[model samples]
Target chain A: MDVTNRIERALTEALSQADLAGCPPRLAAAMRSAVFPRGARVRPRLCHSVAAACGDDNPATEAAGAALELMHCASLVHDDLPCFDGADIRRGRPSVHKAFGEPLAVLTGDALIVLAFQTIARVNCAPDRLLKLTQVIGSAVGVPLGIVAGQAWECESEINLAHYHRSKTGALFVAATAAGAASAGADPEPWRMVGEKIGEAYQVADDLRDAAADEDEIGKPVGQDVAHDRPSAVREMGIDGAVYHLKSLVRGAVEAMPPCSNGNELRSLIMSEATRLVPAKLAQSAA
Target chain B: MDVTNRIERALTEALSQADLAGCPPRLAAAMRSAVFPRGARVRPRLCHSVAAACGDDNPATEAAGAALELMHCASLVHDDLPCFDGADIRRGRPSVHKAFGEPLAVLTGDALIVLAFQTIARVNCAPDRLLKLTQVIGSAVGVPLGIVAGQAWECESEINLAHYHRSKTGALFVAATAAGAASAGADPEPWRMVGEKIGEAYQVADDLRDAAADEDEIGKPVGQDVAHDRPSAVREMGIDGAVYHLKSLVRGAVEAMPPCSNGNELRSLIMSEATRLVPAKLAQSAA
Candidate 1:
């Protein structure tokens, strides 16, 4: 099956696990809302693509991808709460907190995080591969370099742009590539650079969109960096510079891929995704 | 080492994993505050004690116990949030939200939850044993019957006392016993009842305290169950009936032990803990 189908099916199965007998309906629904009407599914796709490139299509790889996606969704749910971004709309619909109230939203995020790990644990795989996948995936969502640390950076008086971006966006991508490789019984260390570069490229594109794109284009509020006074590529570098930097990161990502048996397909996928990152108009203007 | 020291050291190691170099200082501090100056440390003790009873003192068992404690702590931190219990103190000091603000508290809880799973994942145990331990521990914190569901019950329009108590308190205790057994390379299913009875007994004692003990005795605000109009044994059964229930549950816990080699030691530990669950005056009054 295709990567998207694999990810969606895996995710559905995982959520069904959470939607077990006696689960509070609202909490389950809140978790669903945070995940469905998917937002790009970039992380999972990256995970699956890398695993495929590593010449393995193991069920554990799909599970790890789903786990990464769930972690991303969980982070979004928590990040949109009143304490953080306070975003009302996500994926062009009401955010989890907005739809399910704050308390259920909190529990939803917590449940999803647990579900992420549980999804991996439930997969029947070689124990060694499972252990490596769990460690890589777990580290991506935790401190001191995981998304949790990434969010905590916002609370500090002074923030390091590199640290914030890496933790918030890059860590999971790193997990994606590394875990995918690990799931395929390959060395994961060489895959880390690909993830890091792609993650950096994605963040730069996001900043460019936040700075230059229309609100309707992104499906969320624009100029949040200025409103929240968050440091971003656009704020540090000019729009042109940020766009140029994004291109460099994308190229770097393609160059960083470890030599695998099926590298061409993964490379094409990354290139296509890179093209999609910038809005058409922005891409044209930058060109 | 003794159980207490084992639990404390394991917990310290787990927390240090979160206290890494680039972690935001306040977030790190908040995570520490939520855990340190420990409460009863009941869950970990139960876990370690059960592991001992199962004829294993593996480091993985200690790590499982620590993971359980961290999950308990994470639940408490989130439970005390403004959207939930809205408490101002825990363990006789300012709660996580009160001490470090709501946002950090949220992140701290999130970080701790991740740390719990990461703790189990990082343990150098047999792969099959580690996988089983992760599944047991993960189930105790997620959905259907995890603490998150327990908290979600409070958000629902109607609450079932059995479901609430089981998910909220019993789940982790079940995790403790079951994970301990799993870590010890034993079947965890038989140990579930021991955990269930103990957890129920502890909750009953807590209800009695809420209804009958002073604030000073419990180290936090008293009368919260009544204040929040939550379901409780004291409310469902009168104070005397609740006390009677507590004693019965404690007896049941001892009887539920799975006939391990060190059952006598574990039974004695349970009896001693049961005696301590209720205040001296309350125990005497009930007698």
Candidate 2:
């Protein structure tokens, strides 16, 4: 299967595993439905690219991929807590906390955190490499320097968009590539730049969609950033500038890869994704 | 150094590497104080036993030991959340949520989860073995079978005490032994029974105390199980029956260990601990 297809399957499977408890049906269904066909399995796709780059053909690769997705979902679940974002809606539907009571949502988020590590740890890989992957995954998901820190930014009055995106989005990207490399027994350090470059650009792309992309075009509604007064690429750098930043990042990612056979295709996919995310003028329909 | 002291120092140093931002001084102090100068470090001591049993003497054993304690602390943090136990106090002080608001408590719990894997991942063991350790820790902490499931028993209408303790308490014990063995390059399966037996017995002893132990002596307060209407050995098996069960399980733990230098001491410890848990003097104190 293609990387996207495999990632989708893996993510659905991971969510299923995380949801095996005898949860309230409405909550269980909502959590599953929230996950089944997620808008973007970006983290997993990046994971696949890095794994393929580092010659990873093992179950650890899939595990790392699915694990990152689970972590992202967990962050979202917690971020919607009453104290964090107090968000009642997500993906044009009720957020997990809104659909399920806050208590179940709390448990679900807790479960997701456990599930992420479980997924990574269960991957059958060389023990050392698996350790590296787990370490990388853990570092990307936690405080001051990770998604946890990213969420903390919301509670603070002065937010740095750069710092915010790096922790919230870039950290996972860095981890996906690093984890992929670790899975294949790569040094992991070499892939770091590739992850950072792409990760930053992805954040910029996310910023772009905050205003440029319509709600249907992106899974979540546009303009929440503006509503929240959170800084963004579109706000700081403008839409065209964000696109330029993305192109520059794609270049960096392409350049960061080694002379491995899979490198070129990986570069192409990232570039294509960047292009796909770029704004396009729609053709006028026939009158 | 004594086993407990050595393990606590190792854990303190290992936890220092956690560099999450927004760590309030009080939270840091609380985290430090909550663990530091710990009472027994029984879990770490358990890690040491299995590691020694498998002939591991590296500093990585320290990491494995620390990881177990960290995971335990993280579970406590989550368990004390308003949605879970609603516990405002723990270890004779305000719990994490009480000290640092719910958002930070949640983030702190998340940080500990990541930190546990990071600890094991950075250990001196071979990468593959370390990976297994990370996985073991995550599995111990994960849901449906981990501590999260154990906590979920509270939400459940009729949790079998055995099942609850097995998942909540036994799971960690099992992970500790498994991690210790993994650090020593052991297959870890051989030691699974040891953890199960010890974990189950510990819970019975705990329940036995809950039935009659004094609030001052237990240090947390008894009658919590009854207050919460939570299932327990005292509730089902009664105090006398719980003691009998504990003795049998202690026998099983002694029998389960390999014929090694530590076996006699471990057996003695379990026996003494069982005795200490239910002695006439303690009963008098409880009354």
Candidate 3:
């Protein structure tokens, strides 16, 4: 099956276990909406692609990839909450909070996160690999250095922009690569650098879009970085400089791919992904 | 260390790693307060006592016990949110949301939930046991049959009262027992009924207290069951019948302990716990 099909199947099966039959109708609908009508689903794609590069067709890898996407979606749901970004639109639709009300939105995010790990736990794998996958994903979503910590940084008076970017965006990207490797029964350490670079590049690209693109063009509210005084590459380095940094990060990502049987294929994958991730204007300029 | 000391130390160590230095003071403070001014810590006590009864003192048990406490604490934080219970006070102090504002309360709950699993991942255990630990806790906290589903039940127009009580309260108790057994490298399935009965007994006790105790005696709001029209034994079965039911449930809990080396000791422990869990007024009447 294609990565998208695998992810869709895994997510659908996993969510079905949520027993929405007994839950509030709106909450169930909101969770379905938050997951389906998917975004680019870049994280899971990156995860499966890396697992494939490692010569793995393991079900664990598929589960890991699906779990990563669930976490990503959960993060987006919470990030759009009024307490955080307060974004009303996401992926060309109303945010979960905007559609379901704040209470259900909160529960949706919480349930998705629980389901993410539960999804991984049910994957048929050797205990060791499953344990490692759990650890990898847990650390990525957790505190002190995880995405939650990354978001918490925003509440601080003087935020470390680099740490914020790395935690908020880079953490999940790193988890995708590391967990993909772990699920394939390979060492996860080497994949970290590759994931970090991609994560940083994606954040930079988001900053560029936030600064330069129209809200309608982006399909969501724009200029949020400036409005919230959030730390952003575009705000810190200027649009042109941020674009330059993104290109450099993508180059670094390609260089960081671990030597493997499919090293060339993985490099090509990263290159193509880099192009897709970079803002169109920035990509055109760089080209 | 004793269970209380061990719990205190474990929670302190876990919260310390949340990178509070970089997080907002209020967020950090709220997380701390949510944990510190501890409730009865009954769940961890039960977990540790069960592990001890099973002849296991591994650090994995400590970690599991600590993780369960963290999950319980996280649930309390979210449960006390304005949208849910709007509880103004807890444990003789301002509830997390009331003290630190809603946003921080929400984030604090999220971070703590993440920390709960992270705490387990860091435990020194065989990978198999670790995998089981994750499954047990995740299952207890996740959808369909977890505490999250229990809370979601309130949002529904009609709830199966048995399922609601089991998910909302019994799930964690089951998790505590199952996790403790898993930590000890024992089969966890047998321990679940023990946990479920204790949980049900505790909930009934809570209902009795809520309906009958003074606010100062309970050290939080009273009459909440009636206020919200929440399902409760006291409301459903009446004060006398509920008291009779609490005794019966406690007796069942004692009878449900799995055949183990410390069977008598564990039975006695449950009996004492049953005494403590039932309110004095109810106990007097039942006696």
Candidate 4:
């Protein structure tokens, strides 16, 4: 199997094991209903992309890939909690809190976050590389920047999109880019700019879908951002403008990506992903 | 200052700087409340003890000390959520969720977890050492073992006290012990066993209190464990036997502590901590 598919398969195995083994029965039952028709697995894809970009290897790519995805999953669970988004629906099912009790939902999210770090640490990478990856990912998850800030936006009026997106959404992507490169035992600095730019594009596209996509198209509430007055590229810049910026970012990211067998394809995939938000193929029946 | 007082002082300083600039308003507010009457600063005490034993430099000892305590605080916030302990009170005040509402409570807990890792990663230790510290701490927060398991236990049945205490309560203590040793850059394995044993003793004392103590003594609900039918040391061993086991483990922990300048004192402290849990205190209070 190609690297992307291989990682997805591995992730499914790992996630299922996590779900089955440590999960409380109520939680396991809830997750069973919530994880289907999953989103694009965008973060995992990025991890695998970076891993392969760096010449796929053992300790680095596998650990980084699993760690990033686990973090992403944890974020989703928390975001769907009644407190933050109060999102009752996720991936087209009742959210974690709605299905499991709110407390278990909270603990499950906590578990996932810890699992992300555990996945990374268990990798056989040199202690130093594992250490670097842990810091990078940890910084993304915590303070001034991390997912915590992203959720905190709901309570505030003024928003700094740059900082918000950077830590809240972009941090993990940056980690994926860096982690993948590091997995190859190579310094991943060159990929940093690329990761940042791609993350920007990704967030913008998310805004587009949020503003215009319907439930059928997006598989979740649309215009929820405007409804909540949360941050979004469309709110900052109109939808058309957001698309233009996404294209610009895609171009920048493509240029920043290192030369590799998958580099060009990765660039194209990212570009297409940027436009995937259009309520287009997703609303096929409407079309 | 003695290690405990100094580390507690240091922890206060650390919490002040968190989110000082551009912090999410809700996050800042909740974080502010979460730090009040912060628990015993037990993790910092353990970290400092390990560092003192290993001869931690001024910088290493201070950084690891602050980081470990933050993790403990974060875990406590999550644990107190209505979903986990449904604990309306902690350290004699309304728990984080009770004070802030569920959403902010979730965000604050997430932020603290991230902050714990960020603080350690940003600390001045060699990147390798910093990485080691964060990874160890991160493991203590998540998965097959950790706080998540502690929370997950509520959802699973046939409650296993050994595993529950190990993950929810012991992991951080274990991390604190390992972190203490790591400050001096020692091999962490030797200290792990000592921390684990001490952590178990701590849990046993907790069980004894929960089964027999009154609200004024522990400052929280008494007998909640028995109410929940949760397996506990008291349930497992009965009162007198539990006390004896706690003392025996303390002796083992003292003997096992990494040898250092403060070894004798740490042994004494551990013994005293266990001793204070004497059934006499509960009996006197009841009388």
Best by DockQ: 1
DockQ, per model, reads: 0.82, 0.37, 0.54, 0.50
| Candidate ranking (lDDT, best to worst) | 1, 3, 2, 4
Best-fitting candidate, scored by TM-score: 1
Per-residue lDDT tens digits for candidate 2, residues B1-287, read 76776797888776675444543333345455445546556778788877776776467778888888887887778778787677887767777788777887777777777777777767665676676776677767765567766665555546655556777889898887887788877788878898889888888878777777676665666687888777788789776677677878888987887645345545666567667666354444332
lDDT of 3 by residue, A1-287 (tens): 77789888888888887654545455567788889887788888788878877888589988898889888888889889887788999988899989878877888888788888888888777977887888899888877677877877776667777777888899999998898788877889999999999999889888888888777666788888889877788888898798789889989998898876666666777778767755566668755
Candidate 2 docking DockQ: 0.37
Q: What C-alpha RMSD separates each model from the true structure? A: 1.1, 4.1, 2.1, 4.1
Clashing residue pairs in candidate 3 (N, C-alpha, C atoms within 3 angstroms) = none
lDDT of 2 at A17: 55
TM-score of chain A of 2: 0.88
Q: Which candidate would rank higher by lDDT, 2 or 3?
A: 3
Clash pairs for candidate 1: none
Tell me the tens digit of each residue's lDDT in model 1 across A1-287.
87788889999999997667878888888888888977789988888888889999789998999899999999989999998999998878899889889999999999999999899999888988998998998888888899999999888888877788999999999999998899899999999999999999889988888888887888888899999888889999888888888888888999998789898878888888877888667877555
Model 1: per-residue Cα lDDT at residue A13: 92
Q: Per-prediction count of colliding residue pairs?
A: 0, 8, 0, 2
Give the poorly placed runs of model 2, Cα more than 4 Å off. A12-34, A53-58, A154-162, A212-216, A237-252, A255-260, A278-287, B20-34, B37-39, B53-57, B156-162, B275-281, B284-287
The TM-score measured for candidate 1 stands at 0.98
Q: Compose the digit string of candidate 2's lDDT tens values, residues A116-213.
A: 77777666556666667777887787644677766655544466666677887888888888887887777888887888888887887777777777
Please give the ranking of all candidate structures by DockQ, highest first, separated by commas: 1, 3, 4, 2
- Which is superior by DockQ, 1 or 3? 1
Whole-model alpha-carbon lDDT for candidate 2: 0.72
Model 3, B1-287: lDDT tens digits are: 77788888888888887644445455667788999866787888788878878888688888888888888888899899888899999988999888877777777888888888778877767877877888899888877778877877776667778878898899999998888788888889999999999999889989988998878877899999999888889889999999889889889988888887666656776788777766666667866
- For residue A277, give model 2's deviation from the true position in Å: 3.9
Which candidate wins on lDDT? 1
